[model samples]
Target: MENPWLKINHSDYENHMIEVGQSQILNSLKKYCLDKYQPKNFALLGCATGNGLEHVKSNVTNKVYAIDINQEYLNKTQEKFENQIINLELLKRDIQNEELAIKNIDLFFVGLVLEYVDPKKTLNKIIETIGKNGILFIVIQKNKQTTFVSKTKYKSLETLSDISNDVNENEIDSFICLKNMELIKKEEIELTKSKSFITLEYRKKE
Candidate 1:
């Protein structure tokens, strides 16, 4: 079956997220990571249409890898950042099925991506690509009272509900520990009374 993400229109997805007040939150989280870490090399998984990539500065983050499963999203991201961001590399890849060729990323952002893919496989693959002592920022949505797909004017976003799975924070913490990564911090940002985003910061051990 084709991934629902591939079928989602960029505008619809963007509008839906914006309406739900998630895009801005995501942008803020990215900004926080970039400002605090100031990583020379950065990568964003599930980088749809470069939502938070504006935080990337050529002087601070020299290299950027923006990856997404949708080609159209990648095209839009390239159009927006190709001239602005130096060494911006855009890749269209299915993290679940394809082998990631990237390595040595100083900081990696996996925001709301693990829910759509096989969490264990993708997490393992991501760990392999991080440089020693690299930082990893993961954002997982906690939908205790809300549906997996938030209601919006754009119904196209609804297709994602079929593939979206809830990720357990404890499981990831345990898995990363076994993989030689230590948790730097865990923060919970409440989006709504029932919905929140849990941000986990991890660092690869030397």
Candidate 2:
């Protein structure tokens, strides 16, 4: 089955996310998560058009793997940051079913991508790929907005409404505890009148 992300154009997705205050969420993510633990090697899962790519300090976090399901999105990310990023790896994949090719990453960043996939499987895949004591920085919509669908019209994106899964915060916490991972940090960011995000930072059990 074709992924919904592959159906949406990067420009359209970016515009919609910005319109719905996704950039603000990214700002907080960079502030608390990216800037604090500047990992030497990291992967940005669901990195559509590579938002928050600027937070990586070349001298500190030089190696970055940008992974997404859509080829067009990865292409645009390459065009945008191929010069600034020293070791940029662009991976096109469906992470739910595929093992991450790169291993021992210091940080794994996922931005609102879990809602589209089976979170447990995706989380397991990520956990296996990250090194012991590696960080998993994640953000998910805390509450249902007017709808999961973009208020603005876009055929490819609007279809996301059908497949969108609700992320249960309590269930997430339970899962982390069940896996014996430590919850290092967490925050809630209110982006817009109708939008908010619950961000979490977890350290894998060594």
Q: After superposition, how far is residue 66 of candidate 2 from its true place, in Å?
A: 0.3
Query: Between which residue pairs do clashes occur in model 1?
Result: none
Assess each prediction's global lDDT (C-alpha) against the native.
0.92, 0.82
Candidate 2 all-Cα RMSD: 1.7
Error of 1 at 136 (Å): 0.5
List model 1 lDDT by residue over 102-145, tens digit each. Answer: 99988999999998989999999999999988999999999996
Model 1 regions lying over 4 Å from their true place: none
Query: 202 in model 2: Cα distance from truth in Å?
Result: 0.9
For this target, which candidate reaches the highest TM-score against the unseen true structure?
Answer: 1
Q: Tens digit of lDDT per residue, candidate 2, span 38-83?
A: 7888899988888888777888886999999889999999999998
